[model samples]
Target: MSLEVLAVDDSRTMRDMIRFALEPAGFTVHTAEDGVHGTEVLDAIDPDVIITDINMPRMDGFGFIDAVRDRGQYKATPILVLTTEAAPEMKMRARNAGATGWIVKPFDPVKLVKALQMVAG
Candidate 1:
């Protein structure tokens, strides 16, 4: 089966960028415009990996992860967070909330793909 990835961000540009990066690598990329929408998509698709931006409307990355983890289907899913915030505390919070890995923005496509490979593997 093809590996599926959920790319969550508010910006169309960011979401499209992530889709471009991951799709060429043989991944099926699904996108969520915001955390609220992400949850709805998650229920339907159940992507193998989730990469979300911290800042978003209608429920942020942390909220998304929290909601995902609460569900039986996604409890053990690997979640990678991408954010402009680089504070240690923010990282810690993400970790505490259940992120498997983290990346700071302005995102590097190569590194992101590598990270996706690592997580997907």
Candidate 2:
């Protein structure tokens, strides 16, 4: 089955890249500009996985993860942090916020898809 994905990032290029990577792999992609917008998008789609950037206006990835976990239906949903930051502390923070995994920026499309399958499949 095709996995549905929601990608939240402030950079339009990043969102586009994610779409390009995932779509051809047979994954359905949805995008949001920031955490707040991500939350809004979440209300409309029942995605199997979510990929979000750490830096954004209105709300960041941590806040986005927290918000997603707050919803009962999405409490166990897999949230993956996809960002440029590779700091251990940041990864810990995302883990604490209920993220399923973390991926550094400029990710390999194959690895990204593998991670999603491992977490959400």
Candidate 3:
């Protein structure tokens, strides 16, 4: 089956970038402007994987993850935090909050695709 991925970020450019990279990797990507929007997409799509940013206008990535984890249907889903924040504490919080992995922004597109493939597959 084709992989379905939800990419959540406030920046349109960032969402486009992820879609550009991952679409070629055989993923069907859907985007959300922020956590609230992301939650809506989750309900509509039930995507196989989620990639999100830390800072967003409406509920942040942490809140997004928390909401997903709180829901029984999404509790075991794979989530990857793709953000500009690379601090150890940020990674720790993401890990504790149920994210499967964390990736720093300004990331190499090739590497990012590979990592997403590894995680989403």
Candidate 4:
């Protein structure tokens, strides 16, 4: 089955890259500009996985993860933090905020797809 993915990032290029990577891999992808927009998108789609960036104009990734977890239906859903920040403290913070996994920026398309499968499947 194809996985439905929601990618939340401030960069349009990143969102496009994610779509380019996932679409050919047989996944359905959705995107949002920031955490607040991501939440609005979430209300409209039942995605299997959520991928978000740490830095954004609106509600950053931690807040996004927290907001997602607040929704009962999405509490157990996998949320992956994709960011340029590789700091251990940041990773810990994301985990604490209810993220399921982490991926550094400039990610390999193959690895990204595999990680999504491992978590969402």
What TM-score, over all chains together, does every model reach?
A: 0.96, 0.98, 0.95, 0.99
Which should have the higher TM-score, number 2 or number 3? 2
Candidate 3 clash pair list? none
Q: Which should have the higher lDDT, number 2 or number 4? A: 4
| Model 2 misplacement above 4 A | none
Across 16-43, the per-residue lDDT of candidate 3 in tens digits comes to 9999988887889999999999999888
Report the lDDT tens digits of candidate 1 across residue range 1-121. 4689999999999899898887887889999999999999987897889999999999999999899899997888899998899999999999999999999988889899889888878
TM-score of candidate 2 versus the correct structure, residues matched by position:
0.98
Query: Residue 1 CA error for candidate 3 (Å)?
Result: 4.4
What residue pairs are clashing in model 2? none
Q: Total clashing residue pairs per candidate?
A: 0, 0, 0, 0
Better of 1 and 2 by TM-score: 2
Global lDDT of each model? 0.91, 0.95, 0.90, 0.96
Could you give candidate 4's per-residue lDDT for residues 23-75 as a string of tens digits?
Answer: 99999999999999999999999999999999998799999999999999998
TM-score of 1: 0.96
- Candidate 3 residue 85 Cα shift, in angstroms, is 0.5
lDDT of 2 by residue, 70-95 (tens): 99999889999999999999999999
Of the candidates shown, which would achieve the greatest lDDT relative to the real structure?
4
Task: Indicate the residue-level lDDT of 81 in model 2.
Answer: 94
